[model samples]
Target chain A: MKTLVIISHPNILESSSQQFLIKAIPHHFDVTVHHLENEYPDWNINVAKEQKLLSEHDRIIFQFPFYWYSSPALLKHWQDMVYTEDFAFHARGKALRGKEFGLVLSVGINEAEYQAGGREMFSISELTRPFQATAEKLGMTYLKPFSIFQFGYMTDEQRFQLAIHYQQVLTREKDNSLEAKEKWIMEQLTNMDKASLSTDDKIVLENAVESLKNNRHTIDELKLILEQMW
Target chain B: MKTLVIISHPNILESSSQQFLIKAIPHHFDVTVHHLENEYPDWNINVAKEQKLLSEHDRIIFQFPFYWYSSPALLKHWQDMVYTEDFAFHARGKALRGKEFGLVLSVGINEAEYQAGGREMFSISELTRPFQATAEKLGMTYLKPFSIFQFGYMTDEQRFQLAIHYQQVLTREKDNSLEAKEKWIMEQLTNMDKASLSTDDKIVLENAVESLKNNRHTIDELKLILEQMW
Candidate 1:
């Protein structure tokens, strides 16, 4: 499936994490990357072109640094403008129906900061409900979001490794069969030692994880794996 | 207490609901109204100025139309730019600490569509988790949001009546006591028959309804009640 990555950072060139992730996306992958800030510096989006691109891609990825728990202004503006009535909704679910939506986010805050009693007061999954709702409305599949936390504190070695891992996750083929994917994710979380894997490695494992049988795993087992991964 | 109203519609001039509400806001209220679109015509925010306004206000109200389950692009931009570190969350405690944050919103979709098992797949409260998280991080009290749904179908008569009610809610004075405000809200909701209120009206009521307990009624509410005395 053709994947479209809409990169939205106010200053992509200055972004170490975002830039690294962009370069790590597999060169051989059938993916197109569009930078919103660069493409529409004036904020006058080419609505027709954007709609055409959406029509062409089976999967859509929004790549950005999490600012104020959401995306940059241009992406919001793009949604407001490009996702016009006929194209995104109304008159027909003709364009976006059956498509998949993905979010690739990087945050300066630590992972522990996002929790029930944590400093941020909500989990990352909780914070992304709007996107999930949007995907539901458009009849698109809301894939699990990929988040890279503590970007500001990462060492050079960690950044490089994360970049490599991110590319792997973005390029990894999704098992469209829900049963197969579910089984795959369960096995990875149950048997595999997550500490050995990078963020991207965890994603690859997760993408294949859906096929694992529920009886084979327990909540504690999965939690231990996730703890090690973090 | 000083109040700040951040109006974030892309074009409030064209909006009958917002315009009516804006007009109804008393000119002499102890409030500063910031029209985001007017301030950031080029979409380039003055972060310093915004931070100053936020610092000056005891309560901050974000008023907007709900787009894609959240505020418009300008609101996102304001949150990202204005609520920066050192000002909002950096110094042990910050300017936003102890302040109150509330949302006043209108959604195009119907209320029934926002139920868990409904077409929208999530309740409005759930959908606004990101904003809640933001307020939590900034050490602000996140008041329950006010929302108006199915805005496209409101008749002129309904809107006119809503305008008077909207003014009461927006300009209500906040007392020093939280318990008193909470109790007052329950009374107002009972007296006003909340079920009869539109989404827009509910939001204003939820935000400004506190002052009633202190006998600090808004200009609009005072006028209506005093008119009966005449």
Candidate 2:
């Protein structure tokens, strides 16, 4: 899929985390990285240009450092200027409809801090409801957010691993429906068996397939019980 | 209570809803209306001055028209710049501790659209979780948000009534604690009986007092049940 990452960080040049992630994006994929501050230094967003960019992308990722539990000002400003009713939400202007929308956040604190009993007092998912709501209003599929917490504390090796994970997340095509996901898993198992592999690795793959089959059976049983109750 | 309303609308001069709400602020309270866009036209936030303003207020209100399911970009920028860990969150620099924090939002859509089954697919409370989480981190009281929806659809009379309601919400000293609120209600009833002479008004006040008493009784009964179970 054609992906566009709109990065909104006030001091992107100074941010090591963002720089690291930017370099990690796979060169093979058709991806455009649009830096909001760099593009509009004076805060003047060209609506037509932004809408044109949106039209070209199948997946739109809003990437930012989580500032005060949300994205920085420029992203909000971009939304205010670019997403006018005539371009984003009007019946005739549903340009973003059926496109995938996601957030890529780098949080300063530890991941554990964003929980019920934690200092931040709410999960990242709960705090990001605004983004989800926006996607819902625009008729876009809201993808699960990609979060990297405590970037400052991560070692070089850990940072490299995270960057690779991020690239996979951005480029991978996610089939969210249950049936589609199940079919994909089955195809993966079949491919694993056909491919020449070491005995140990083949055993691991077989165990994983067995576990998935058991999980599917359990889910089906639960569904049957729910249907009976209804 | 001393109240500081930080209004962050990029184009406040053109918004009638914001102008009306501004005019309705009660004259009795010590209230400062800080227009962020006008103050920081260059987007250069004076951190010390902003911190000083926050320190002086007992209640800090972030007032804005909801843009992209959140506050305007300038507001987020202000937060990113002004709310440094050394000033807002550090153990030794807990400037916002025990203070009240609230959001005053003017959403373009109807209020009903912000529910689970509605087009918006999330409640206002859910969307505003970031602000609530910020308050929690700062050890500040997170007041229930004051939202005005569909401002463009309201008639002159409706607007006037809403303005009055807005004034009450902004100026009112809300004791969020159940015990404190109950105590305040009882005191109001006592004061009403002593000052009022009209029989109809007196009857209305009496009914309110009776309802409050019943509510208190029910709460006490529930507490007793919980204690017994424990």
Candidate 3:
């Protein structure tokens, strides 16, 4: 899939987490990393260029560090400028229709803090409703956000795992059916034997494949039973 | 109450609604209408000046047109810059603690468009949770946001009424108890008799006073009954 990762950090060069993630993005997928602050230092967004980029991509990921429970000003400015009525919503046709929207946030605080009774007093899901609304308005599928909290305190191993997880999230097919998703995972695991996998990694993959096979079998049996009843 | 209305419109001079609202702010309250875009044309936020303004005010009102389901980029910029750790949340003494934070949004779309099944697909309250979370973090009271939607479609009479309502919202005393608020309203009405009041206005004020008196009586009775039961 053609993925456009719009990174909106005011001082991205200073951020180690962002640098690490950018480097970790897999080479296979056609990805464009458009840094907003770098492109528009004066906050003057090129609307036509942004719209063209959006048209060229299937999945759009907004990657940013959460500033004061929201994104940096540049992202919002980009939205205000790029997602105009003629381009995004009330265009000649719906420009972003069938596109997928996703958010990848690196927050300063710990994940535990962003809960109902916690210090932050709201979940990441609740805080990112504006993005969901925008996606909904433009007829795009809003995916569940990928949030990395307290990145400054993360160990190297933890950061590596997070990058791998982020890449998986970005490249994953937008398959709605559980059966299809299970099949896809199984297929991926089956092909991974060629890769120089560790013994522990092989065992984990085998276990996942086995669990998914069982699930698929159960789902097939249920479908057969429903057909028979009908 | 000392109210500092931080108006963060990109182009406030062009907006009739904002102009009308700004003109309507009563002279009685110590109101500071800070035009953010005008003050910071280059987006270089004066952090110390903003912190000083916050310290000077009892209530800080974020007055802006809602852009992409939130305030404009400049407002977010202001938040990121001015609301620093040492100023807003983690100073020797909490600067924003015990103060009030309020939002006044001028939206282009109608109010109905921001409901569950509407085009926007989220209520204003749900979307503005970031500000609420900010307030929670800073130990400030997050007041109910005042939203004026579809200003272009509003009649002159409706616009006039909105300005009056806006003024009332800004200047209203932060009284915790119902009795104190009722007393304040009664006092205001008593003083309003000296002004050249229309018959309908006089009748409305009288009815409001009567209703408040009845409400106070009922509340007093309930308190007495609760005290006796205890």
Candidate 4:
């Protein structure tokens, strides 16, 4: 499926995770990456160009590091301008209907910090409701988000793994077959026996699952690929 | 009690409800009405000016029409800018603590559109969780939000009444001794008892309660003042 990733980072060049993701985007996949801040530095979003881009793609991903628990200033400006009345919304018909929307989010806080009793005091899901509501209002299908937590302390290996996982989620088929993808993830992880693994082991297993799907290779093959990645 | 009404409407001059509110601000209330869009048309918020303004007041009112279930774009920009680290939060000497934070929100949807099965599919309070969360984080006391509903359909008389009510709420104190405000509202609109009123009505009653506590004016005397407001 054709995918359009709208990167909304204020400064991608200064970001390790964003740059890693940018490097890992496979040229083989039908993908187009649009850097919103680079394109509209002054916050003047071109509504017609944005609407046309949306019409041309089946899957759209909003990639950004969560700032103050939301997207950056440029993305918010894009939402206000490009999603205006009589264009994205009250148009001839619902122009954005049936398009798929997903978020690729990175947060400085760890996973534990996003729970109910966490220091940040709100879950990533709760903080992301505004975007979910936007997708709902625009009649687009909202997918489960891809989150890279505690990005401030990520090791080089962890960053590489995250990029591989992002590539998997981004280039997935847009047809109604994500349940198959979920089952594929379950089978790839070490053993389906969930009670034995520690939290860190589970994350490794999950990332392995994602990488296997993207490369269409087995977990053993993924280990071999990672061994040769450098 | 001193109050700071920070107006965040994009175009206050073109707004009927907001324009009326700005004009009716009482001279004796130590009120300062700020037009956010006019001040920061280029989206460059003066952080020191904003912090100084917050320091000079006991209550900080965010006055704006509800846009996408929250404040407009410029107001969100203000929040992202002025409510920064070392100022609104995490500062050794924080400025926002113990201050009152309230919203004067005007929504286009009617009361019935915000119930469990309403067209909006969420309660007004639920939609406003972000603001509440912001207040909680900044160590500010969140007063009940003042809302004017069904703006697209209200008659001229109703709009005038709304403006009068808006002025009353903006000037209300943060204490609990304003019981007569509730009683007077029930007298004005005898269609329903006070217990069954909507969220918008609750704000007006609370404002009246606040006004009574601060001004020490009888309900009849306040009525006479509003009657001669023109």
Winning candidate number (DockQ): 3
lDDT of 2 at A138: 91
lDDT of candidate 2 over A105-204, digit per residue (tens): 9998889988889888889999999888889789899999999988889998998789766865676677667855675556546644345688898888
Q: What is the lDDT of residue A105 in candidate 2?
A: 96
Against the hidden true structure, what lDDT does model 3 obtain?
A: 0.86
Off by over 4 Å in 2: A155-157, A176-230, B155-161, B176-230
Candidate 3 regions exceeding 4 Å error are: A91-93, A176-230, B91-93, B176-230
In model 3, pairs of residues that clash are none
Can you list each candidate's DockQ?
Answer: 0.58, 0.60, 0.71, 0.23
The best candidate by TM-score is 3
DockQ value of candidate 3? 0.71
**Model 1 spans with C-alpha error above 4 angstroms:** A152-165, A176-230, B155-161, B173-230
lDDT by residue (tens digit), candidate 3, A73-129 = 999999998888887887465899999999999998889988988888999999999
The lDDT values for all models are 0.79, 0.85, 0.86, 0.77
Greater lDDT among 2 and 4 belongs to 2
Per-residue lDDT over A1-230 for candidate 1, one digit per residue giving the tens place of the 0 to 100 score = 78899999988899877767777765556789999988988889999999999999988999988888888877988998887778888766458989888899998888998887888878888888988888877889888888999887889898887875565355545665655445444433665457778999888766555424443456558778999999
Residue A54 of model 1, lDDT score: 93
Colliding residue pairs in candidate 4: none
User: lDDT of candidate 4 vs native?
Assistant: 0.77
Score every model by TM-score. Answer: 0.74, 0.76, 0.83, 0.74
